[model samples]
Target: MRSKVLITGSSGKLGKRVLEFNEGLSFLSPSSKDLDITSETSVNKFLNQNSFNTIIHCAALARMMECEENPNKAFLINTQGTLNLVNKVRDIEKSCKTNIRFIYISTDGVYPCINGNYDEDSPTIPYNIYGWSKLGGETTVRSLENFCIIRTRFFDPLNIPFSESADDIITSSIEIDRLAKIINFLVKDEFNGVLNVGNEATTEFLRYISHKPNLKKCKRSDITKNLNFEIAKNASMNISLMKKILSS
Candidate 1:
């Protein structure tokens, strides 16, 4: 039997790409109105009406400055919302006698960013509120028996949103379409635990130069001065595990 998949935050950028790449699968892409992860009642109601063997949770309050401005909202949506989903999923799994595979779309921001090439075993000390909230969600996801936490950095290749790129700050960022394809492959395999998914480490400026030639080069300090929250200087991840899994 084909696995029934439920994808939250289907309207977002990454979610939309995941949907596009995961074609021909039995997917339920519910809008926020149809299923709100923040509300336990909403999650329960949706789960009761629909049965899915897999869930790809993509909903999160991701902006660093916004999270700093309203920590309460960030916690409510990213942390509490994740808890509600996990709790309800656990209940549904128990009652239905089925194992639900949870795929959590986490971030590389969980690390302190003091150094790059962070692996799955790296120490998690978030530099900002956004990272803290995501780390909180990671905690809940870790408690689950059958779950995969993917910590990745991805951006749209066609749409480079920024006019300037930081030359000093580096990341192991992959194009969103490529990342989505990898995610589709992983979700079907018998892989459970945290996986770091991205490309070779590169500076923000070099990464965007090809796509946006007119983009101005700037240092981390230039960008950080305008923002109230702290940002990672080097958020690159070690993708050896991801490569090994994909190869096997």
Candidate 2:
């Protein structure tokens, strides 16, 4: 049977790219106005009315500085918001007696970046409010019988929003288009649990330069020193699993 997919956060960058790349697939990309995920009634209403076997959950208040300023709002949308969807999915699955594949877009920020090269088995110690909020969402998704929590860094290669990037800090960040492709693959795969998704460890500046050679370089402290909260120092992941999946 052809899978019917429902992609949340369709307006967002990653969500939009996912839709663009998977043009051949049967996808339902709804706006927040049409389906507000933070509202239980709204989510339940949408899910009940729509018939889909796959869910790509990408909705979250992911702004790091904003999350730091208002942690409660972060948790409300990220943590409680996810719980709302999970509850509805469980209900739908029970009533319909059909499997629903849930693909959650998580972050490498959940790792303790004090030491780099963390894997799926690594201890989760978030450095900032954004990280903590996402980690909360991941906790709820784990309860679902069929779910995949993808932990990775994602950045737009065409649109690097910053004039300068950190040279000192390292990450396993993947391009937005590639992220969309990989997630689509996972949606069809039998894989579950956390998968570290990204490229080899490289400085943010180096990754940024690949697309923007003229971009200026800066240290991590140069940016974080002005901020009140902490940022990931070296949140690079062991993406052997990601590579294995791609190769297969």
Candidate 3:
């Protein structure tokens, strides 16, 4: 029998893409209203009614500025909300005597972006509230026997959003469609622990400006001067492990 999968945050871009690339797996995709992860009672009520062998948790307070402005709300949803799901999953798995795999969507922000080339064993000192909140969620997911924490950044290539691209700023941000494909493959792998996925170290302008011809090339200052929070500089992650897994 195919694994019964529960996909949270199906409304989000990543979640939606994952659903699109189902890869012949059985999926139970629910919107935020149907399964409010922030509410422990709501999570329990929903999961109790269904049985799942895998959970691809993509729900999160993902905005950087919003997380910084409202740290409490960020933690409530990203941290506490993840804990609620983890706890309940444990209960259900124990009762049913079946293994449940959890795939957590984490951010590359968990690493200090001071210098790039971060490996899986590198220090995890978050530079912002968004990273901290996701790290808290990671802590809970670690308690599970089978879990994969994907730490990377992804952007919709079609929608660059910004008119200016910083040539100096670098990141491990991959195209949304590519990242979704990797996640679809990861769902079947039995790997436990964090897996860094994305392109090699490259400037933001070169990676992002290709899709937008009108986008002007600029220095990092031109972008950060207007923003309140600091955009991660050189947030590149080493994806050697990810490639190995995909190849295997």
Give candidate 2 misplaced runs (Cα > 4 Å). none
Clashing pairs in 3: none
Order by lDDT, highest first:
1, 2, 3
Residue pairs clashing in model 1 are: none
Query: Which digits, one per residue and each the tens of the lDDT, describe model 3 over residues 205-234?
Result: 898767887888999888778778877888
State TM-scores per candidate.
0.98, 0.97, 0.97
Q: Give the per-residue lDDT digits (tens) of candidate 1, residues 60-105.
A: 9987788999999999999999999999889988888889999999
| Candidate 2 lDDT by residue in tens digits, 162-216 | 8999999999999989999998888888998999999999999998898998899
Whole-model lDDT values for every prediction:
0.91, 0.90, 0.90
Q: Which ten residues in a row have the lowest lDDT in candidate 3?
A: 223-232
Rate residue 227 of model 2 by lDDT. Answer: 94
